[model samples]
Target chain A: MQLADRIEKRRFVGRELLLWLWMESELFDGTLHTEEHGAFGFWLEKQLVLSAESESTSIKAAAPGLGREAKEALLRGQLPERFAVRISKDDEETSLVLTGDTLALRALKLATVLDKKEEAVIGDLVDELAGRTRGRKKKKAESEEDEETPFYERMSKAAEVEALLGTLYRDFLRLRLDARWDAVVVPTMRQWAAGEDVDADAYRAAKRGKSTKGAKGAKAAKGTRK
Target chain B: MSALSGSLSYSRFFVTLQGRDGTIRSAGSAADGSLPRGFLDRSYEKLLHHAMRPLDADEPESERSGWCVLGDPLDVSLPKERVYLEGFVNLGFRTDKWVIPGAMLRTRLRQAELAYREQVGREKLSRRERAELKEVVTRELRKKLVPSTRAVDLTWSLDEGLVRFFSHTASAMLSMVDLFEKTFGAKLVAESPYTLASRLRGEDDPIALDDEALWEALTPTILVPEGDA
Candidate 1:
């Protein structure tokens, strides 16, 4: 469904909101699952979890019916080709593992009742991760033990995990927005942009570009010519 | 002159800038250009979070020196209803030698554009021949590495007359702010606004419009708010 439509219906919940978003957003299709056994299980799995944490607080409450296969997928880190999953270690806690573009992540995050400030906070984490990796050169400054270490593990000294959790909490706020972001807001923004007085006209103009396109029709240009 | 020398890959060459307040911003490939200027704001702090460490090579540290923390990405978003690319870096900033030279910058942009066109050419179908080509391009692009939103950089410089730009990967359109800022260190000389259009059917020119005029011409659509559809 169009995110706007979904947003209006108010049917999306935490991990589901993130799952739907990660799968459908412009970036790519991926899954979210929670992994237990801590970081050890996380590494043993084939698929990588985007969030640093193994589980989120709300995983259990959202998906009471989560089965062994799904849980195993999280444990093995095996993600399907076109989906994203979030695995929480606590079975109740939830975190997302999205494989898509920035915009997709933004939408899913925004869908939850996340305020701009929280989003900005997550945006900070993204910036931090992107910055830390920039212009980095790969050389063995340490022994074989360092080589076996996961990349994130190396980042431990730099506090990458802590920073990721900060973003995770911010992301959770966004997940809740899925339950809170009213699809009605789309029309509101469109109405504001058009500077039109009528809500109906704004809604139509926003829904279909007909009004805006027609507004800029030939007559407007010809009238200016005179 | 060149990107920090070492076998740099996508992960190693990037850095995460955390605002003291808490936000995540992305900088481009080391070779592409430096981070955007918004990251340089007071709340921002740079972390050498990841670097590509070669298996067994020794390299000089000075190669990585030009790397400075730019500003946050969100703070420099495009102004409301503007057609312009936001946060372009002024090229004159390179005059100090910390930045790459304009001539070299132009060549890199040109090369990137050529590679993009060549990829399209391999299909033997013009972009217009099939509606899906755009999707293909978009999808493939999503898979590849990207440094930042817009190509090139724009920033505030002490000078008012000259514009400066640090070029990045050549995307569909080269940002006008990048062009103008690189060209003029200061604000536009004229009071009147100018239109930025492609000189040819496909080329993008900077200085097409000052910020004010561009915003007036654009109509906000669902695409902007819901994310690039």
Candidate 2:
């Protein structure tokens, strides 16, 4: 088979990964602490979009700050084709509009280090460029600075973004391709997604059909989706 | 540092490709680590030239607005590190417009009506004619006008299968993909679940991936609230 065709057959994996991520976030308080991915935080932000893989087109729903509607969409048996998600590992944070099939980061918000690193570079470059433009007069005592960071800052930040994306995506792949992933991880996630006890089948059975028993009180807490 | 101050660096995509010798490399080098000179490649320009058509259907190629690689790769990083590209593309489209102010246009129409006296006068133009005139005027004006210019920012990580482009519009994305394919003589598939999955599986696990039941099982079953179900 042609390489494109071979890959196209598996394009749904991206979507499924995204769907899995959304489910993970919704079920696990957006805290994913696998040995591989570390204690990463993921949250579906202001928007949530779901589409059937079989569907030819895509549409998005704006997830409310309170995630009742988004949860309801999950109850609707649909999966996301594209959605904006916030991912963080402690102080570092990135927001991305990740598409399912192509695993494209259609829109990306780089990690916070983006600005810190960028500003540092820009400041240094600007100082050097400024020095060159004005014949290298040494002036270390300037309190004020140009309000705009030079455009060149994007190059360095782009490198950082790519690196971080690679790391995160690899983490995801590690999680997905693990031998235990399909058999163990997903079923537990499925239970978690429904706000059920992973161990207690009876509790899940009873929780079905309008029985607000175990953690209706903690629903908002477990899934702090907004 | 602050959320409000945060701005995106660029849109990131995954590029996967296979060579003729059955070697599939997501990120391939030109052997010497140079950004594609494909902007100057005749095929790239020709493809873009046709895409940006003349403002009018009958207008010739000379009148068309199109894309050009403004210059060399905007920036090239080390011996084999990275390449940044800034592309220039022209946009041309016919517009029906009136340069005259609305009040003036109305006044002119009223005056032309008065000039008619009885039936329509020589100065009086019908709505159809006025629209036709507008098209002709706009077309002529368009010739004098330069096509709008936009700067596309792109960075290709030579070693990583990543391309970060600032523009996310469909047109820009398609253009970048086309440009990359032409430049590298390889296809760039935006790394997605499927492509990534296939790559991760490697060439050895063909049987596991190809199993129809395994593929079917991989499909998601939406576990929704039974109430909705």
Candidate 3:
């Protein structure tokens, strides 16, 4: 199943960092930056310029019902940092498209926080936004319906899973372990295998809080979060 | 760099927390950022009794004073004894002469961030819940984030050097005047309450220019004398 627009937009932010984390794979837990000198204007310009380097990717930053000049500036220059915004053939690409200024930086930071990339299934963000607009208009008419929907009711179970995956990614990012992929890769593979139809017993055991001990390929699971 | 002539900079501050139930406690910048013992007591002694008159304890008087400055302490009632620490810093007045020390501010903010996270560990949330919580918290932080410790508007002119200060909240301005007076030792001259009242009424009252006018104005509106009524 595909993710929604807000989730995709979040995925877009995570993707920028995820590209590096995916390649490095081993170090995806968490990453924090506390640079006080980095002004909002400075950070936005840096992320945009870096995100735009991809040849095939379309980077955009629109203020939604406002002028587009700020968005255009994000595309103008090469980023001052050494990190290249690499787009690979195997798994697609990651980048940001946003208007210039501290507001863009703030937006990017918030988007990054909300994003959980590796586990999130991708959705067409444009379609999601359109659907939301249509739903909001119609929801008012449905107010007479007895049941009330929780604020987060629309989020699927998969979205919850993806969020956990993101947290794992953030932790790895923070640890900066050289072999982080080894830490996360194997356990994720095991979980996926368990989720599959075959070896249903092993999957059930893991789900029942039995712990995935001695089920074949157990050594690979060591050191990784269960 | 030359320090400005009459400008003042507040090097440090302290806030004493007095709960509605009268549980008085204090917090301030310890030399090394650790909480000092009797902090609340000393601060209260200095600000309330020694410097400004003690705040009246009566219900009506206390209500006019202010809320519990410390706010609800880290809601320990939650599964984790979690607490959030927030304080407003007054960057010096807006004139070019005043400067906010960037390094000091960064250090304090970093400490605040670390303190918050350490108080809330991973066990506090289920794996999935923590992930969603992270996203929400991060988004909120980013939205309200300020790049530098210094957030203020600076304006300078010749006639009346009015350095109007703004901050995340009005309470932040509590020690601002004290800091200025202590460092610069400049006398604060507010218009006498009687003078202000007389001016408003278009008549000069003899009592208008006296310092006691503040106490009188604050005493509560007296009902007209029974004969006058």
**Local accuracy of candidate 3 as per-residue lDDT tens digits, A1-226:** 1212322222222332333332222121122212221111111212323233353223334211112332232223211111212212123222222221110111111121123232121323443666644443333433322123221221122123223333334332222111222243333333332232234344224323322222122334333433
Against the native chain B, each candidate's TM-score is 0.19, 0.46, 0.23
Per-residue lDDT of model 1, residues A1-226, tens digit only: 4423432232212223233332222111122221212231111122323221363212232332133443333233222221223332332222323321111110111111123334445655676677753221212322232333442222221223223322332332222222112232233433333333435444333333322122233234323431
Reference A-B contact fraction recovered by candidate 3: 0.00
Q: List-wise, what DockQ does each model earn?
A: 0.01, 0.23, 0.01
Q: What order do you get sorting by TM-score, best first?
A: 2, 3, 1
Whole-model lDDT values for every prediction: 0.27, 0.48, 0.26
lDDT of 3 by residue, B1-229 (tens): 0011111111111233344476533222122333345532343323222221222222122111111111121111211111111222112221111122457445554554555557775334455655554444444443343222222321111112122232323344444444434422232221111211111221232122222322222221111222432
Q: Candidate 2 chain A: worst 10 consecutive residues by lDDT?
A: A138-147
Off by over 4 Å in 2: A1-11, A26-28, A34-37, A53-66, A111-182, A198-226, B1-6, B9-24, B29-139, B198-217, B224-228
Q: Write the per-residue lDDT of candidate 2 for residues B1-229, one digit (tens) a residue.
A: 1111235523556555564577655553334333335523544444443332224423522232232222122121111111223431211111122233456446655554555534554655678866655455445554555444344545455455556555556666676676556554556665545544433332433233323334433434335535754
